[model samples]
Target: MKSFSDKLLWGIIVLLAAAMAITAAVKLSPLLNPPQDISLPLNAACDLHQGPCTTSLPGGGRLEFSLEPRPIPVLRPLRLQVRATGIKADSVEVDFAGVDMKMAFNRPRLVSGKEGLFTGEATLPVCVRNKMAWQATVLVEADGQRIAVPFRFETKR
Candidate 1:
């Protein structure tokens, strides 16, 4: 009778282990399969000159802007960085609002040993007292393709 009860207990444990294994497999099956891709429409557009200080693509490109203070009071300089893939431009330019400043940057190139990555920077004049927002844009022309990115910025008064 004791042997029979011991066998029953081991059988119950084995069954429970099998059930847990099946449950785990079912829960994880979705992860093992390829996910579906979702697409969205492009709303408005960015021109050679126009929105935010920084604009990022849905894919993997990003544009960043930074402000650097100059030695002279009330004068601020801006530094812009762009990292992108699959796009190349002949030139890039930036324009500031409420200030008569137009700065240009050279074309972007891949950092060594990396593919599809580009970076460049430009400096522009800014006023801290004015606290006005600024506008910037990027134009890329390569392989008969033209892409423009617009940006806006605001500095403290």
Candidate 2:
């Protein structure tokens, strides 16, 4: 036979254990089986000199990408800017990579500026060849979801 206080203490301990177990399961479920990501292709042909290029995002939103200075020079400071519309984003980052070659360290996290605009500075690495193709992947985080938009272009020396 147990006292009333002992029974109440045991009951509280059981409830707390149950709550912790539920929290752990919710956090680990994603690691157990990750969700598949969908890639959205930009329809517009982006030329570095022309002006800012626009693209439609998945769901309902728009993304505008631009770079300062035409013909994108290597080993120099380049300004990368993005303007997003009809979307709520907490943060934005650009991941720069070579189309064919492997570039391990070029991704720079952009800081938000003004309204719906994010800007960052990044430098492209010089390749052995005079010409190289690069991809700038913009990652937007909104409402606990991350979306990636890729812009491809070629550079020449």
Judged by lDDT, which candidate is best?
A: 2
Q: TM-score of predicted model 1? A: 0.37
TM-score of each: 0.37, 0.73
Residue-by-residue lDDT tens digits, candidate 2, 53-96: 88887778989989877767888898999999988877887778
- Top of the candidates by TM-score: 2
RMSD, every candidate, angstroms: 18.9, 10.5
Candidate 1, RMSD to the unseen true structure: 18.9
lDDT of 2: 0.80
Which consecutive 10 residues in model 2 have the weakest lDDT in total? Answer: 30-39
